[model samples]
Target: MIVLDFVGVGLFAATGALSASRKQLDIIGFVFLAAVAGVGGGTIRDLILGVGIFWVLEPVYIVVCGGTAAVIYFTAHLLESRYRWLLWLDAVALAAYCVFGAYKGLLVTGSPVVAVVVGTLTGTLGGILRDALANEPSILLRREIYVTAALLGALAFVLSDAIGLPQPFSACAGFVVAIVIRGSALALGLPLPTYRSRPGREHGAIR
Candidate 1:
């Protein structure tokens, strides 16, 4: 499970750098983004529980963030297409973190609400931090259903637990909810609603 976390850590750092790169941010921006993206969720969790941060004892956290930033800095041109694959990759990482968070929360705190909230933070804080750094509109802040999707996925996983499903199967079901939500968003261009636009200011109104 730590291995999976590392993979997600690396991927999310990579994703953050990709977002930074797309915004044409500098190297400092990349490192900052990576650092924030790497530790954002853990930081939030620790803070909420009134515990000291987790990464302080784990140098691997710094190494991963720094290494991911370096890779992005030197290989920016090679990954110009990152934006194209960002959504799917983000979904994959999101699913991994959600399962891991829920598992840990349930094991440690044994509270379903804690499990769900931690799972959400674990799944989303990195992207939220990334958006904050980029000054790009957050996927969460927009009129989209980003956090809603994650919460529903977590709910599904919790339901699976109540039904006595295998942990792995439950995790997969939760992951599927996230993937389906994200994929459908991608395929159908789903987004939040907005007020009416003037005739000349029309922007493909959905409602």
Candidate 2:
């Protein structure tokens, strides 16, 4: 589980590095953004849950994030299409983090609802920080089904756990659901509907 968490951190760090590159940042900036993106979500989750921060408890995770950033800093240019790869990598990280967060939440709270919320936060908070630091619009605020995908994945994990599935199986179910939903959105351009004001009807409901 620790290794899996680190893998998610690495993936997120890569995306962060790429985002920094897009903004023409130096290596220091790249590493800083990468570390932030890698651990922001998990740090937030741990704080909210009143659990000790994972990376602080286990410094290896921080090393993984830093090492990942350094690697991406050096090799980012070699990647033919950074944005496309970053999207897919971010999806994978989201799925992994969602499952990890829910699993931890279950151990702590034993409530499916809490687990799902924590999982969703685990999946998205890092990306939100990444975007903010990069001066990019947050994916969470976009009309696309980003948060919905995380929610579905977390829900699946909780449901599976509630049904007596093994830990590994439940986690896998969550990860797969998240990846499929996110990948579908990326490939098919799926988006949630937005509210539109009707020319005359908008004024009738409030007063």
Candidate 3:
């Protein structure tokens, strides 16, 4: 349901704002980052689907994002590194949001393949926008296993569904697959497989 999507969105907002806080950004910066990270995916989905933009159509979405932002503004430091802080939570949020977006694409648009793409877009665009807006490089530029893994997991869900998996079971499996893939990446320091750099470009910085 959309409520679950909003919950995942809220968690993401909190984590983004928390990250901004760790960087010593101002309260307004944290809130703005939270909103960007929260709404970015939904906006992409709406735009792709020609659905008149979800947040514009629903004030609940904005309210949920804003509320999470405010909470994070005050409680950011509550999540210390001792708890593994934001990373683990963000991973979980990513998994849930992926499933949520895929569900929307399937239900709203009735296309499993498109659903997978939408899921990946929904789960990742926010993080990309967040990083770029903060004057940091996009996560897509790193040799890190990130949104591509999400897309793969989402597509796997579509495959499972095509093979007759029930909606609930498929969603659960997809969510777990994403989390495992991402968690393994984090735990094992999995880097994205890279090719040789172009003729004029430098490489091996992270290597």
What TM-score would you give candidate 2 relative to the actual structure? 0.91
Q: Please say which candidate is ahead in TM-score: 1 or 2.
A: 2
Please write out the lDDT profile of model 1 over residues 6-120, one tens digit for every residue: 7667777878878878888888888788788777876777677666676886778878888888888888787547775565666777766766666667767778898888878
Can you write out model 3's per-residue Cα lDDT over 28-101, one digit (the tens) per residue?
77777888888887788888877788778777777877778788777766665712456666677778888778
Clash list (residue pairs), candidate 2: none
Give the better candidate number (2 or 3) by lDDT: 2
TM-score of each: 0.81, 0.91, 0.84
Q: Per-residue lDDT tens digits of candidate 2, residues 115-169?
A: 9999999999999999998998887776668988888999999999899998888
In order, candidate lDDTs are: 0.75, 0.87, 0.76
RMSD of each: 4.8, 3.6, 3.7
| Ten contiguous residues minimizing lDDT sum, candidate 3 | 78-87
